[model samples]
Target: MFYSSSWSKCLICLIFITSGNAECPKPQVEGNFVLTNDALLKNDFPEGTEATFECANGYLKEQGSERITCTSGEWSTLELTCKKKDCGAPRKIAHLTYEFGEEGTLFGASAKAICDKGYQLMGSSYRQCYANGWSGRPRCEVVTCEKPIEIKNGTITEQPDKEFPEYGGVIQYSCDEGYTLIGNKSIECNEDGEYNSVPPECKDGNDIPLKPTTTISTTSITTTTTSTVPPIIRDVDDIPLKPTTTISTTSITTTTTSTVPPIIRVSGRNNGIGEHDTNAATGNAAVVGSVIGTVIVTLIVLFTLYRFYKRKGSYQTGEDPSRKEELLQFKNN
Candidate 1:
């Protein structure tokens, strides 16, 4: 019994010795930070052991202590505040403007480069903000125009210095004696790097081409139509005919009579007026009829527009309000 008690006491002592405060897992917290040299080297963090941190790249400390302690096998909440570092405003470039994006001048920000008028960008237009400074060096180059093409039988008497031509530069041309200039004598280099007008041409005064005298002739065709000059018959029997119309809204019907001019057929001999002459007369009559129809339609439209304006004016004008009341009363009745 005494030996049994001694064994039980020894077991109790062993268990107590084995169970001293357990070492905490590696300490960690939520934020953009890195552990100190001591904390990173050691894998084990006993309870009450403290660890230190520093802000990561591109970030600077804002507030709060960088140190934290492990309590009861757990890391304390992160109290360190780290904010993005500033790269400062970019340097001013000649003829260059910038468009800073959100979070301006801070890390990871960007600026779009814009060149002024008569200039163009030469490098990457986008510059990014970094932990050290901006990413690339962008520049603006002035716009220029190429030399004008040579004109035939003409000479470019006046132009900008042979080196290069910029915006608003003009090139003047002249023709040789006995030759005349065709188009504008001068071409200008506008804001965009291009000639504003086509170059002029030089043409000899005696070298002009003319059209043929009988160029109005129709193509080769043999006609058998024998009718000679379709007679212009104007009488009461051939009065202008119209179709019938009926209005359902007013229960009104209008009936009209149509009279077709007689078709006079002649022998199938080649008369002075054959198919060509007959067709030409018909075409003339059609053109006259189209002109008359257009005039009549225009008059009708003008009358309709006038009547609409008169009706609208009657409503808008302050004349005879009592008359409108009387009309309303008549309707009700």
Candidate 2:
């Protein structure tokens, strides 16, 4: 009985040791290796539990555990991790500028983007590291606005000299003459670089009046007169009646005549006697007579004045109001 009891105690001790050893399973030597958070580590399994390692879409198997088993209740190692997809981070750009990561970190499953100086970011700043082993490549672009110069009737006179840095560029407007500009004089570049208002218009000017016309008419009329004459008369003593000899076949004769005088005027004449005269046959005799008479009268007056001067020179010596002569002087002896 004593021997049997000692044997039973030893068996109980062995069973206890076995249970403890199984529970604490030695660090896995051959089960499998696992990658965790970009690192590889051996894991000890727990009682009644099993584990398996798998990479996400953007990850790959490098040197990590794919699966582990619990034979006596001990695990192999911690869950294995998958290396990040080999693809690089999405390209980053700002204001048309770009930059790249110094050391591409794909294991962390994070993607980064950046732009160069003087440029600004346009789209999403971040990206995802995909299971395919790469981050979504982002696009970088430039930003710009619209230009000014909205033309209505006519076109813009000219374009800007230089490219506008801002959104809206500037332009000036003009129109053909006889037409007036109705809208804004100058155009501005909007933030989007578009014109603000519609183009100007061309209008007409004022009007003037005209002159008038007229017409005229003329007419004429005629009249006639008739008369009968009595038989010819004779002196009382010698009065002779119609001759008896010619009474059988008497005949008589009659004649008529008409005359027109030339026209004349009396203007610009020195005297009342002018170009009017009865001498119709002499066309210019009266005019010539008038001119000759005037010349002769002038010569007579000049000769009389000369004679009066000679007489005065021969006799005159003293000054008298009536005589009206300044006599020549003689030297005294």
Candidate 3:
């Protein structure tokens, strides 16, 4: 009975030894970090063994210990926290600046590029933080315009000495002795790094176009003479006169002649004179038709009022017919 009790004691000791020698499955670090190479190669991590972790690329250890201890056939909790690494600012360029996003210059973040006034962006307008470093080489450059095109028989006066004119630069153009400038007297550089208008042309004085002729048609009872009106009022076409009674043998003769003022204003912009359009004729026809229709309406209203007073007498109950006549007259006028 003593030997049996001793054997039970020995078996209990052996069980404790086996349990103490148990090995942990494995240790795995989260996405932002990784186990050391030596720790990853060997999965047989015995109880009480230690494993160290390393931060992944573009990440940095933020807090807590990177090392963890294995105990009781299971790995101990890792207290290491990781955060994105900062790439810092890139090399500076003239007239260039950067504004960061919510994440700033840390990995995977972006920055916006800005240029000073009178300067333009010449490269990518954004920079990104990548694994290696910031992504692009952004730059800003002074605004400039291409040289004015060559014009035959003309020379550009007050021209800038440089190959490209800067913003707000002014240039005057002049023609040779027998030539004349056919556009604006000067071209100025604008904020867009371009001239306000194309360079003027130099043409021989004899080749300049003559003023255009304008013709207007009209109708009259006895005689009609040509007359001028405000330039804003466009010429109108002949309007046919319909007699009160039909006469089969009568015919009308009409004629028109005019010399339009100089249509080409040297503003280097459209002056309502270049392209041909039917809108002007349409507007004139509408105006003439509206006047004739208003006159006919006035006559009809007067005739209606005369009949209303002569036949019906009172304008229904207490309504005033004179008020309506006054209103109609005001509208006709």
| Whole-structure CA lDDT of model 1 | 0.71
Residues 116-155, candidate 1: write the lDDT tens digits.
Answer: 9888899998998888899998998878888788998889
Residue pairs whose backbone atoms clash in candidate 1: none
The lowest-lDDT stretch of 10 consecutive residues in candidate 3 is 226-235
* lDDT against the true structure, each candidate: 0.71, 0.47, 0.71
Ranking by lDDT: 3, 1, 2
TM-score of each: 0.52, 0.30, 0.52
Q: Give the clashing pairs for model 3.
A: none
Error of 3 at 272 (Å): 34
Q: What is the lDDT of residue 201 in candidate 1?
A: 92
RMSD of 2: 34.8
Taking the candidates one at a time, how many backbone clashes does each contain? 0, 23, 0
Evaluated at residue 254, the lDDT of candidate 2 is: 20
RMSD of each: 25.6, 34.8, 21.5
Task: Name the lDDT of candidate 2.
Answer: 0.47
Q: Regarding lDDT, does 2 or 3 come out ahead? A: 3
User: Under the 3 Å rule for N, CA and C atoms, how many clashes does model 1 have?
Assistant: 0
